[model samples]
Target: MKTKITDFFKLVFPSTYSEVAVFLFFIVCYGILGSYIAIHYRIIFDNRIPWDAYFSFDNKSILMTGGSFERHPLSYYFFNWVREFSLFISGGKMDVNFRLTLAWLSNIIITLNIIQVFKYLKNIIYLPLWLSLLITLFFGVFSTNIILSFTPENFTYTLFLLSLYNYYAAIKLRKEEKIPATALSLAGITIGGLTITNFVKVFIPLIFEKDLFRSWKKFGNALFRVAITMICFIVLYLNRIDFKYQNIFSKTNQQYEKFSNVKSMPTWDMIFSFFFGGNILFPGFIMSDKHNMKGFNFKGLYMDLYSSVIPYFFIAILLILISWSYIKNFKNKWVQIIIISFLIDIVIHCVMRFGLHTSYIYGGHFVFVYPLLLGWLFFTYRTSSKMMSFLTLTVAILCTYLLVNNIFRMLEFFWFMENYYQ
Candidate 1:
């Protein structure tokens, strides 16, 4: 066992016993910066980290299963039970200020989960891992202005990251890596917990479609997957108590109606922004906006959060080159997994609502689907020129650095009131 632990670090770091050290370094850096900012900015002096939501205080109950029964969805009851007991033990609901503090902590958890989930991708190239982490932090944490914005949205999104990581772990397992079925099961559970989050997950089975017909024998394994999803679905349904979020959907959709192009973006905008956010690219959170007093505004050829960065898109282009070069050379199972998941991510977003702002230009959720595309590229490029590998790495690092810096400045403006400077 000790030997195996030693070997794991060797594989991750290759040269030295630095994998554990570097991982801890990243964690500590994240912890100290995030904790200090959250603590300094929190409204409550005694606000603690690891905050909890007070659902029981709201007396909320979910109605699930098409409203066919009087019982709240099982998920609703489960969470209610959790909330009640948790609050009871923790000394009860906190003030609004403390609640906001908790939201920041929740965002912190979400950020950490994303970093952990993508840790595997680091093995391919260290750059993408850093890039992915910063992207997750920028959009998922600092940019979302999410500390003040709490919802099942944050919880489900965090779970979605877990599910993605677990799915990748399952991939590692197939290669005989030291992973387990727990990752797969956990992935399903995370998906089942949130309706919108589940959308990213429906892509899972599609990856197995080609294998399904050939086996018909793996029916038991497939059934287990189905069973897990069912349990998760039950948990999500019961927790929300209402599977019908059409009203919420409808309200948010107003931005869609108002902002959606009369047609899908012109193929030019679609294809161009697909890779870059157009010519306006720099760093530093658009600091000018902070002093505007009216508020920061984003205006450019393409301003959607996901659509904002174009230079980091070499991975997408690399994937295209690989497909064109070796369509016939692809026999690996994981390659197929990458192909299918990438396509599904694209399809799900294009069909669903993707825009900017609240309806302003809100492609944040949709644009994130880029990672799987990069995964495909990474798999393809592993054997390519070291220069190409380095280029890909450079793009990813720059992409993340810019986004993270941008977000840091945005927070500075909001927190420092920089624009309204007296």
Candidate 2:
């Protein structure tokens, strides 16, 4: 009986009991700490932000609002139910309670996503417990978008990770046997989730087709799964189709054009911004305060802008070089897929021309590159000296620490606002 149970456990979790337990502890700690910070410190930085205000809207108001179901039809219903559930749990219907409830949900999902990342790292590479925890903490701190926010990105990321895991598992299984139904179903679900949440992520499936030409039957199965998921997405999409929100894309395009005329910076600034510009590495420091356009520069509050930019620029260069070096291991399809996916994410954001100020909004989308690069490096150089590994991990932690201080500053800014509002 013990043998059977152990087998079951092994099938379920790729990591050892201790590794899983340690990551689980980290997830819980991150959730609790992150929640306290967000609830006590983080303010509603902007009211104009639609995704941030998602939970604040009641069902009646939500339906009346044109953009409520625009990008995320499925999430619209789900978050409304969450808000209703939270209201019931609190026994009082204050907006603060709703935000708190949704923030907790977001934080938990974020932490779970972090755990999934650590698990993926464990599956791909062998690292010591201390190093693993440090890397996980690095991800928790620097991946600012996942910390706590009621956005569809949270759900999308969760689905993305799950799909990637299942997809990778399927690839391995195909070496021994045919793709299993469970793997196909999981991939289909991911497709559906990505479709409903953000079509931009539709590129994910393309990353998993390394064995396509070798096996037509396997490729056919993948196509079948995608086709079915896409059909479901089309049905769900058509159900929520209203002419009312059709103008949003056109309206945003006009805003984009207007913003584009602000004059492009030097080639160096553009290059630096491409890598470090989007508040990607340090969202807290780089992001402008909600009312900054009204005359408050956050950099002035922190330090000279150059000082802030210097560290992030170097970090960006480090990540890019690390990924590039690892990509030389052309034998590893997973490395290539992740690198390509990261590049695709960067290019899409660039083409959209998210400016220095607004680029932070989509920074979360590309932060997945960090874990991918780390995983690739750890595996490709598993035989490296301890000193080399220590240095690499140190850089990752330092980058995360820089982001942490910025988060504190962000909290401080909110704390200051609290006094004014009170």
Q: Choose the strongest candidate by lDDT.
A: 2
Please list the C-alpha lDDT of all candidates, in the order they appear: 0.39, 0.49
What is every candidate's alpha-carbon RMSD to the true fold?
9.3, 6.2
lDDT of 1 at 305: 31
Which lDDT tens digits does candidate 2 get at residues 199-276? 434435443565765788878876776565566655665565553456546655665575344343443444354334
lDDT of 2 at 153: 42
Clashing pairs in 2: none
Model 2 ranges with Cα > 4 A deviation: 1-16, 37-70, 143-210, 242-280, 283-309, 354-356, 386-404, 407-411, 414-417, 420-422
Candidate 1 is scored at a TM of 0.54
lDDT (Cα, 0-100) at 384 in candidate 2? 74
